[model samples]
Target: MTALLAAWCLCCSLAFASSYPLIKSKPNDTGSNLLHEGHNNTGMADRCSDRGFNAITLDDKGVMYYFRDQYVWKGYIGPAELINDTWPEVPVPVDAAFRIHHRNKPEVHERMFLFKGNKAWAYYENKLEPGYPKLITDVFPGVPGDLDSALECPAGECKSDSVLFFKGKSVYTYDLSDPSAVKERQWPLVQNCTAAVRWLGKHYCFQDTMFTRFNPVTGEVHPGYPLDTRDYFISCPGRGHGHETRRNATLMSIKNRCSNRSFEAFTSDDSGKTYGFRGGWYFRMDSKRDGWHAWSIGSTWKGLKGTVDAAFNWENKMYFIQGSQVTIFLSDQIYSMVQGYPKPLQDELGMQQVDAAFTCPHSSDLYIIKGNTLSLVDLKNTPRVPGQESSIIHSNVDSAMCNSQGVHIFTGASFHRYKDPNELLQAKELPEARNIAAEFLDCTQ
Candidate 1:
């Protein structure tokens, strides 16, 4: 009876201990009023769900704005912002958008058009045009309402400097010079283009998370039609080998991928890019994404070679540990290794055989994990002795991280999260490990 009562009390304490919601999971976002009760603030809605973007357009300066529902991503990779913040006059749920760019017609060229339902909005440099919020029928005379997507078709690559309006499987080609003479045709290449854009003298159409490059004049979709958006457009971490199934491709279970499996090293850098390493490959986890994509260490880290044992970002520098060696790289526009790096772990920090290394917010100390022991080493002293050494909850931890919110001890594909290091040491007994992939990394069943 006493044991049962103790177990219930422990469970209650654990439930109450989880006060901090995991980072990048939602809320405290933008610090804007938009981070309200029900509104999603984790940039790219639903934690990197690619249901599809409704509209995409490039500004006069060639800056891309990808819109999905009420949020807009300024660049390819984004912690998205509310549409009203950028375009206060423009309404939400934009169906289609396109910017005009013509050297000959400079007066009207920079103007952009956004379509939704029966309404058409025109803006020049983000300011609503004098006469806008016009009906779609009035804007193009014959263009249908509730457009799927739209893009500007320049004359050099097209028959005319026209605008392509997509709806369902059909397209309406409206020539800017001759708006009355609208041509409509069934587009067999792609159906219901979710968003379309004219980028750097080329035209591309998107359907869902898939896209196709095509010629507007010849109506020819390039041979490699319907490519995954993450491949070229955005910087999506935890990405797989193309969403489309290929005949020659070998499918691997989630167990094989570090994203859903054991991690050799894990760190959330000062730049806010969360990375997990396994073997020779590393996965960059986006703040707003519940996905994983792996890249080779040799290819990404340049000079860094082989699998890493531990990684941690301190100040503006990133440290990668391998066996008894440690390599430090500067976190900047380019991650360049510092001079005289790849130093002996013992010689550099007086630590040996580190299983994992991590640091929490506002702390100048690095926590080194070895077996079940943790050694707190100050960054101020090199070849330093341990300041506060203690035994932690888990033994033989595959990897670990102290991501501001809490400390996670990763083992195999699962992770046991504790509120903090002090609490874990106090508890003695480890908590039930949760599937890291299932909760945030989104493993394939």
Candidate 2:
């Protein structure tokens, strides 16, 4: 059986958000920072924090459009501006919008479709196409009017280039290549998609102030999602109530310098839920959790305490390596720490502390990483023991994961995708496929 999970949740600027309003943890108190903290304070007031958007779309030139009641925020870093001031031909308060940027299709000419009421308008590079304001059905057959949100799922992600039209809890997938292959389904996590946009190569579904990153092909959302849209999408200096945007972080929300994506101990268990550890909090990779985001590690994991150096799952059990010690937990129906499991790492795995570790899909070999070197542990054998350590592809590995897709090794804010375990084991420096900030989390552009 194969597992699917985000390689690692980028240690985001908001991973341990003090802006969350009245929640505290012990992690930042020890004077340790999982990542650096930025100190730049934007003097401007107002937070892109809790406001909702009516429509969201990205242009070919990388400009992001965020609409909310006749106003729009045009880029990642900016204040709200009048919609008419920018796109003169486009109407205000567009219910839904999606871009068509296919190279093969010239008739549409890299245009954008904006929906309002029952009518739809096509804009080529923001210029309204002639004979527009047509019925929604006429523009996008099989799609309903008054959509909650819409975004393009281009080829390679979805089977074919397609558009997702959202309404309440229902999603209508309109295939661009084949009009007859329309599909409709219910996604409970996305109760209301006020806005959604496809940036880089990932898809995001938004509601209120939160957004969830999801796969366009399978509609599988990353676990521990539904994070704040403002933290990742909009740059609001003094966002955490006087705290400014920075490349580092502090304990208190008042001192937060949000926007450095770094994380520790990223792992996925037998149940398929992925967990990302940062400071005193952890983000679970599921969006179905009641409009929630991060959780205190102690509040959920139970009994496993202190700093987590590395983490991985084997035989339906979770292993969290912290400094010289390791904590084991039973990951069955109920998450519980195994008795007498806060043992020394050397006693159990014949090792001290490690940088990162992960078990690949359909294999019994567990890769335990340290620095740029790694040791192998055969899980199918009687006793688990680390073999000779040798050099590997990445250095300062923060986390690792394995799904049917491939083995992902995360370092800093970007990660390398190895087609399989063997491909990763033989590498010196593989090509990085995605950035944790841009692709994994909907945090940066």
TM-score of 1: 0.48
lDDT per residue (tens digit) for residues 18-125 in model 1: 111111211211111111222235745641466668887865534567788898766434466788887887778898999875556777786788887999888776
Off by over 4 Å in 1: 1-259, 287-291
List clashing residue pairs in candidate 1.
43-80, 238-292, 238-293, 239-292, 239-293
Provide the global lDDT of candidate 1 against the true structure: 0.66
User: TM-score for all predictions?
Assistant: 0.48, 0.50
Q: What is the lDDT of residue 419 in candidate 2?
A: 88
Candidate 2, 1-445: lDDT as tens digits:
0101111122222233332311111112211231222222343323364677888775543355677887765544345567787666666678988777565688784587888888888877567788987998887788888889998876766777888889988998888887777799887666588988775345788888888877666667766787877565555544432233223344432222123346776778765667766665565543221111344466456665556778888888888888899888886433578899899988777777788888865567788888888789887765568988887767888888876667878876677888876787788667755776444433434
Q: What's the distance in Å from true for residue 442, model 1?
A: 2.9
Q: What is the lDDT of residue 391 in candidate 2?
A: 79
